[model samples]
Target: MPHYFLDYQDSFHDLVDVDGRELDNDEHAATAARSMLAGRACLEILRGADAVISVRVRRGPTPLFSVTLAITEDRFHLNG
Candidate 1:
């Protein structure tokens, strides 16, 4: 198992994961990151904060993947 850090990134700064977790593979790490990003608590955060909040998937100091909740605005409606 390899250690993966799910770091939280905002516009101003990044909140590093001091105690990272050891996962089975990259897919597992990515799944965890997505879950953290799209959780119900995060939705509440999105409602209040204007800046985009993203999850940075990293192995040691190297980044593997990055994802965030994207809000699309149009005349008709929106999509995530």
Candidate 2:
């Protein structure tokens, strides 16, 4: 199983597991999980904000196997 972390503005917000169906295989699962995690992270940041600035992916401890999702907001630009 793989773990995912959602960060907002460099702050931890939520964590979740990526569904197996969303991925092609265990390896891809990790990648999709990380991407979804990033989306979730960005959503968290834009939940109440007026606009999204940016979204980013941060490689975690398991860069080769694991990853982190980060979201950033600046003015009216959102990057992911």
Candidate 3:
């Protein structure tokens, strides 16, 4: 297992995951990020927030992957 950081980003704020997460790889982290943002449980919490937000995955100081969710557009796209 490897440690990865999930940073939450939007126009209003940039939140860094100081604790991070231990996952198998970047793909798993990407899925987790998408799930976290798209899950029903998060709907109420994130409702009325930014239409587009991003989850950035980083291994220590190196960025491995990123996923952006467009709530208004109902789309999810991944980036590196």
Candidate 4:
């Protein structure tokens, strides 16, 4: 097992996981990041605002991977 830090950010907030988590591997960390990003994105969507959300995975001082979700409203694409 390895220690990983999952830093999360979005249109309105930036949070760092100082305590971090102990996981099996990088793959597990990535999966966790994606799940976290999706949950945050859903919350933003419910609030009726466009959002850009991401989770950055890091091992100690080294960044390993990032998962992101960007949502924007395109009024022109909507059929009125």
- Evaluated with lDDT, which candidate comes out highest? 4
Each model's lDDT comes to: 0.80, 0.42, 0.75, 0.90
Residue-level error in angstroms, candidate 3, position 65? 0.8
- Tens digits of per-residue lDDT for model 1 on 1-80? 99999998666667999899999999999999989878733564556655576898999999999888654334565686
Clash number by candidate, in order: 0, 7, 0, 0
Residue 53 accuracy (lDDT) in model 4: 88
TM-score for all predictions?
0.71, 0.33, 0.69, 0.89
RMSD of 3: 9.4
Task: Write candidate 3's Cα lDDT for 1-80 as tens digits.
Answer: 99989888766668998999899987898888777656632663457554667878889989988877665535578896
Candidate 2 per-residue lDDT, tens place, 1-80, comes to 34433232324333322322333345554556466556665566667544322222223333234444434456676798
lDDT of 4 by residue, 13-75 (tens): 799889999999999999999888888888888887788889999999899999888888666
User: Considering TM-score, where higher is better, how would the candidates rank from best to worst?
Assistant: 4, 1, 3, 2
Off by over 4 Å in 1: 11-13, 40-49, 71-80
Q: Top model by TM-score, which number?
A: 4
Instruction: Give lDDT: candidate 3, residue 52.
Output: 66
